[model samples]
Target chain A: MDLHLGRITWFQGGRDKVAREEVKSLEVYETGPTLTFSMGPQHPGTGHFRMVITVVGDIVVRCDPDPGFVHRGEEKMCEYKTWITNIPHLERPAILDAAGMTYPYVLAVERLMGVEPPERAKYLRVIMAELQRICSHLYWLGLMGVFAGHATMYMWCFGDREYLVDLTQLIGGQRITHSYFVPGGVRNDAPSKVPRELVKNFRTYYRMMLGKDYPSGEVPEDFRKYVLAVCDFFDTRLDEYYPMLLDSPIFIYRTKGIGVLKREDAISLGVVGPVLRGSGVKSDTRIDEPYDAYPYIKFNVPTMDGCDSYSRMMVGYYEMKESVRIIKQAVEQMPEGPVKLKQHPVTIKVPAGEVFASAEAARGQCSFYIRSDGTDKPYRVKICSPSFRNLIAMPYLIKDVRIADIPIIYWSLNYWPVECDR
Target chain B: MSLSKAEEILKRLIEDLRSRFGDRVLEVNVEPKKIVKILVALECIKDVAQYLKSEWAIDYIKGVTGVDLSKLPNNAQEALEIIYHVGSLSSEALKGITISLSTKVSISNPVMPSLTGIWKGAEMHEREVYEMLGVSFEGHPDLRRLLLPEFWSDGPPLRKNYMVPGREGQSG
Candidate 1:
């Protein structure tokens, strides 16, 4: 009756021939009713990822998430590149929020170099990062809607996301991989006319699209007023968003109690971002370890005790509002100065030291452990991405769930394959 | 918990470890703003980990980072250092503190006790360390390659000595 009474050498190959033969002799070989199938690496539901699942009838009994389809050896490749050049490719893992992905890396390098950015540059970094967070969350929201078979939701979310993307382009000159974040600060400052342009665009958009007149032109000297006005405009748009998606009967029915992860399980599994917050753990790196302009901003860390797909989705929705608030505050309080330090990017030398820096990215806590050996390039770079940690919970959450709920639960966890595999 | 309270708890934890572990605890370096790094003998790592879990309530492991020290000229023993970044969500006092428990094993005999029994979250990270750094984690339930292909016959890619196919000219 004791399972561990004897060593199971059946998997040891030819060396365990006797044990293998004994196992074959004792067993009655009969095919089980369970169906085993490999879903993805090319499937529509899973993006460039594969998971082998064994199911009985419609319920999944076992699941194994096989990532690494997009592994480009980013960590190892960092050793060959200079401190500054690595920023562009390092953000590729989670391109939707490029600034968020590279923020921690820049922080770690700065710590090693013993230099701090100017106050203006810090606020600029915060603005760029918050914008990236909104863009990334919108992208995930669209994907979530698509996974649940709501194409209109996808169109709306993606369509709304372009405005933020345009703003990012106006500042960084690139839409996706901005390469905007550097060691001492961001690459450049916002143009002098950006505040007026933003205010005008938001007012025009609100009046034309939402049929609501946004009061503007008050306190034009403060960029924060315009940013807050835009955020207020989005607050109105979000009111239209809830009843259409979260309150829909189908959406509620499909995600209400499905793939429930308890708070303990979520913490032990190392899940982060909205998934961790949804399970009622009040842990966000942005709040816990205030970095950039996070300390100056005031916003509530949204949490839900439901621990279900719906709760996670709601967390994502509420977080977008909080990001808007943070951006507005950061813009309002930002001091005027040079956006970047006068240090040269290519020839910078960092002293021999190691530091680990973490930031709350859209998916979760993105951390970078960089070890420098008094050189321009790093000795070793270790990236612990949120998607990789959250992937550990997939096998546990997928158990006993219907096969149809697989994509819903999967996307709800926000497991970005590229980030995980990196 | 406030920063000062977290530091007090960390100091008390270190003192308790010193009393309990005696000479087995090699070094305890506390960086109040960063992390608390503790190096222990390979033989006493499991006991130290158990004490941290049961006594200090540092339950969850944030990550398991393995560094291959075989390439270093001074490390003639050719050791592999594994640092376990363990913390807790259940305990409010210990939430702010991250205890980094590290142990080193000779590369020729790279075997260490797995912490999966203590923290189930360490499963995937241990598998990754096993495959990437070639450290055999004893008592790990499923010690297979987590990221690499099954048919991968090359030496552990993360090891400093493992040369990439066409990039021999570049030095680390």
Candidate 2:
């Protein structure tokens, strides 16, 4: 409802309206009275990205986002590596959401190669993907807290994110860049050794302290309880974030009406993920075309009508809750089976065909198009990253706000620079 | 997914295009995935794009892709293939489907009309195609190098003919 349309009018040093009207061109002002400067590929706000902004008085008149600082020619590089060997570097662009990044690529390869992972592998993949979604949203929220001038929110978010990170390390066998996905299935099934060890160690400690051994087995009271408990703890923990950031007066004042992208503008620019959902669009790849275990497990795609920075942030905030619900369901309903169909040789040749695979990533929609020409190496692989698709929305929104509010609007889109340049 | 669900949507759309332009629509392919492919001649690509946007309501694009077809075995035709995968945001029935419209241009002078006039989101994608594959869009507003550095001019790196530096004779 609130549409500033890229000309914010409030400023401490307001130039006379009649005098400002005479200077019609932003380019003229750039050459004359306006200040034109390039912000960072190094500026903490625009990580690995630069933007040239021209401002007249306190209002921005023109913006040019330059985002090739982290370009590594990822698609070109994929041509050289075999399909299985490409997973590690393919996910490097979005290391925080590695599972979400490579899910579609692996699915696409599986579709082309005509192989299906076992049923349990599908559930495991969904659990890891949703866990990483919550992890990724928390990282974004922590950085956004700092951008909103609230260090406490930053500390709270990063601290809580560790629980999910630890849970992920238990299954994924790594901390951050988990190349856990393979063509037919995941790299390995969920490990019982780590959790069994933890439960066994806890049983010994409880007997020594309380003088009772109680009951124990090979499964050791099941690992599913631990995953469910984390989900329950996070359910209440995420509720706290809503009031701390969303309901607080100072936080709302900074983000509520800033960078309002109207519904029409959002659709025309082809924005995806939270940026589009925040603007009242009922579209998500997971719901529209259910992938992995999403077809079985039920979840909601949260939508907001505010069409502002606050709406985008709230959509991401609420999506984490849905992700938690999904993780709980996947763990409970998982079937017992082998993870992979069969072990193929290192050099697997896919039949000549083309496939397009898409997944709902933490940031938004990420898709991969693979064209195989009956060879181990692919003829082409095109990555359509959500950050790159959302790039147009930045210059469109940043044209009207004050210089101080730029970081608030920029971080609200949750645009990661490395992902965009890839 | 049930393949027929996607196929049902693909059938109606392909029928509409075939009826409208008889000879211009060259090829139609339905893969096992949730995608529909239509290959049109080079000249009618703009008309097909305009028709899809105005009549069929395939509003937003996923991405644009280009493939060099020079190095394929037993292939004599020299050309660069371009593909545009489109979907709808407003229409729920058509949300999951992707219709990739492809067109080919001569490898020597690969110039085609840009679709940015209709879908403004393709501006950066067109620039990227220009930078990576040397396939220029004639009517594109800002057709410059997007991700490539300013000074590099060896060749379009994505093209099959352009060998990566220090990796010559290292064919897989």
Q: Which stretches of candidate 1 lie over 4 Å from their true place?
A: A1-31, A195-208, A212-226, B72-77
Candidate 2 residue lDDT tens string, B106-163? 8777888999988888988887887788787878876656676544446678988878
CA displacement after TM-score superposition, residue B68 of candidate 2 (Å): 0.9
Residue A223 CA displacement from its true place in model 1, Å: 5.7
Q: DockQ scores for all the models shown? A: 0.42, 0.33
Error of 2 at A145 (Å): 0.6
Chain A TM-score, each candidate: 0.89, 0.87
User: Docking quality tier of candidate 2?
Assistant: acceptable
**Clashing residue pairs, candidate 2?**
none
Candidate 2, residue A41: Cα displacement in angstroms equals 0.7
The C-alpha lDDT values of all candidates are 0.80, 0.83
Model 2: per-residue Cα lDDT over A1-422, one tens digit each: 01321232211122223113322321133467888887787899989988878898988988878788999989988888888888999999999999989999999999897777889999999999999999999998889889998888898888778768877888888877889989888888886544556545544544543365533323244568767766876787798898898888888999998999988888888889999999999888988888778899989999999999999999999999999999999999999889887776768888888898899888899999888888888889999999999998988999889998889999999999999999
Displacement of the residue A6 alpha carbon in candidate 2, Å:
39
